[model samples]
Target: MLESLLWGAVAAAPLVLGAVLAGIRAWPDRLLGIVLGFGAGALIASIAFELWQDGLEQGGPVPLAIGVALGAAVYFTADRLVERWAKRAGGGAAAGVPLALGALLDGIPEQLVLGFGLADGAGVSVALVVAIFVSNLPESIGSSSDLLDGGVKRPAVLGIWSAVAALCALSTVAGWALADVASASIRTGLNGFAAGALLVMMVDSMIPEAQKRAKDLAGVATVFGFALAAGLSALGG
Candidate 1:
């Protein structure tokens, strides 16, 4: 459990770093878009290679299908509700809340996967960890800045991200606890669930945001990010 917590924190620490960066300096939208593009690509690759593939192998097709469907439905529904609430709040001041919710949606599943991976006693999923770290840094930077732009007090912005980081870190422990007693099918379902959630998140939030901000260059960054993560996975395997 302690190990899981340690690794989880290590993976999520970038959010704090991103918040500090946003607090300290101004980042151009183009740059944030490019970073998000890369992160989206990397996360997509993680879904394919890290989460889904392993899940399919461990639990076979049925659970994978079920988990994926449920994960997508839940995330999509919850995201819409959050967006509606944000809109109801009125003005750009509420924009950051949605972004923060999005991050939580994305982060929790990824972190859960991290704990699950560690639970096997097979060591950390270095590829997944690297991808998570890479993806998170840009996300945090963008979200933190959005919060600032939304007129959230700076300290409050930091506090929000800090709390998120702590929650994600603890989610790993939850995964670890489950791993200790779960059947193979359950483990596989969890992986598939994480994959589905991540895919929906990328399509619904990350990719659109990247395109809105980076324009054409976002494509290039995405390709590079995918290639980089894929290479890392191949090498690790």
Candidate 2:
């Protein structure tokens, strides 16, 4: 139980930090390009060094390819649907629903994959947790900023973020439980799929937004942010 809670905290750390960072000044738009560049690099590295290799070792090329293709397709379709919905709703509750539901849906699968990795071995789990944490930090910050920009009160923003963190905890715990019953091949495939999905998400969404906000000190801050993430990944490794 203590171990699970500790892992949960590790998972939530990035989101908490991101929320705090979002309260800072907006970054410049140009910096978004740079951040996206680094993010793309990181995603590639994660896929090559961790997800792809691990999946191959555990399942083989066929399963890894299938998982990657499926994951990519799902996210691509979901992204299109969400964009359409957001366009139709145009800032009303309907607009918010897609974003909130997307975020909520994201948490479950991601945490579940991480939990399975962690259950397999400390090294695999730690590497993935670190990667996800690094990725989530920027995402959380962006989410908070979007909410605030959309006129959400600070208290409400904090509450929503906190609730999401709690959901992450639940997802991680549930994943750990599932790890006990699931086959290693299935777990590996799922993790690979998650890696692919995250790559698409970072490329198409997070990095683009971060780049849009990059300018002046924001550019420098974005570089610092990537450095921090890289450092954390190294330390965790």
Candidate 3:
């Protein structure tokens, strides 16, 4: 459990770091959007190389399919509620919503995969660890920056992202505990759930926002991010 917690913290470390960096200076919206796109790209690699492949191996087709559908449904419903709340709150509250969603959606499963690997005695990959760092950094950075821009207090923004990072880190321990008892299908289902939620966030939140802000450069930034993170995954293999 201690090991799991430690490793989980390791994976989530970038979130806090990113938030801290976000406070160092006021960043331009266009640059922040490009960074978000870059993080989304890294997340894409994580979904493909880590979540989907592991899920396919563990649960086969049926459970993965069911998990994906369920995950999508849950996220969509939650997102609607979030949007309504954001509208009610007024101001730029909605701007940071998707980024927060992305962090929540993928953070759990991302660390859980690590926890499961630890439990299974699978050797941790240094490159994959770096890949997680790559994926998480810009996410928190963009989210923090967005919140600051949206009229959110800096202290509150710090608190919010910090809480998220803590939860994600704890999820590693949850996965570690679950691994001993969870069947292969269950593991796959969880992975599928993460993948499904992440994909949706990418489409509705990350990609569109990046495109809206960064315009033509969003695609280039995304591809650059993909190549970098994917290259890291390749090194792991």
Candidate 4:
């Protein structure tokens, strides 16, 4: 469990790093969009190669499907409610909350999946870690920058991202502990759930946000991210 928590923090470290970079200076919207695009691509690759594929290998279609449906429903409903709450609690830059919150929601399951992967004594999945770290960097950077632009205090932005990162690390520990005693089908379902959540997040937040800024360049950046992650996975194998 300790190992899982440590590794989870290692993977989520990029969020804090990204937030720090945002604190250092304001980022141009176009550049931020490009970064978001790349992250989206990397995240998609993770869902395909790391999460979904592995879930199928572990428990087959039925469990995977059920997990995916549940995940999507949970994320969609929760995200909408959070958005409403943030709107009601409007402050200087509360707009940033939705984005950061989305990242948090996305990260928890992902880190949990990481913990699950480690539970089997198979060692860590280098590909998944790389994908997550790469993907999370842009998310924090973009969201933190947005908060700053919206007149949010720097410390608050950093604090939010840091807290979310910590939560994700704890989630990894939870996954590891649960997986230790879970049936094979349950493990597969969990992976599927993570994958489903990831897919929804990309569509709901990352991709649209990216395209909102860089437009044409966003597509290219996405391809670059995907190719890079895929290449890394191949090499790791």
Best by lDDT: 3
- lDDT tens per residue, model 2, 128-200: 5667665565556656667666666667766777787788777777777788887767766675676667666
lDDT value, candidate 1, whole model: 0.78
Candidate 1 global TM-score: 0.90
* Clash count, one per candidate: 0, 11, 0, 0
* lDDT score for candidate 2 against the true structure: 0.61
- Two-way lDDT contest, 2 vs 3, winner: 3
* lDDT tens digits by residue: candidate 1, 63-119: 888888877777788877867777787656555454456567656766776677788
The RMSD of every model to the true structure, in order and in angstroms, is 2.0, 4.2, 1.3, 2.0
Evaluate residue 9 in candidate 3 and report its C-alpha lDDT on the 0 to 100 scale: 90
Candidate 4 lDDT tens digits, 18-88 = 98999998788899999999988887777777678878888898998998887788778877886776677
CA shift of 83, model 3, Å: 0.8
Model 4: lowest-lDDT 10 consecutive positions: 90-99
Clashing pairs in 4: none
Off by over 4 Å in 2: 24-40, 91-107, 117-131, 215-237
- Ranking 2 against 4 by TM-score, winner: 4
Q: Is candidate 1 or candidate 3 better by lDDT?
A: 3
Q: TM-score for every candidate vs. truth?
A: 0.90, 0.73, 0.95, 0.90
Distance from true position, residue 69, model 4, in Å? 1.5
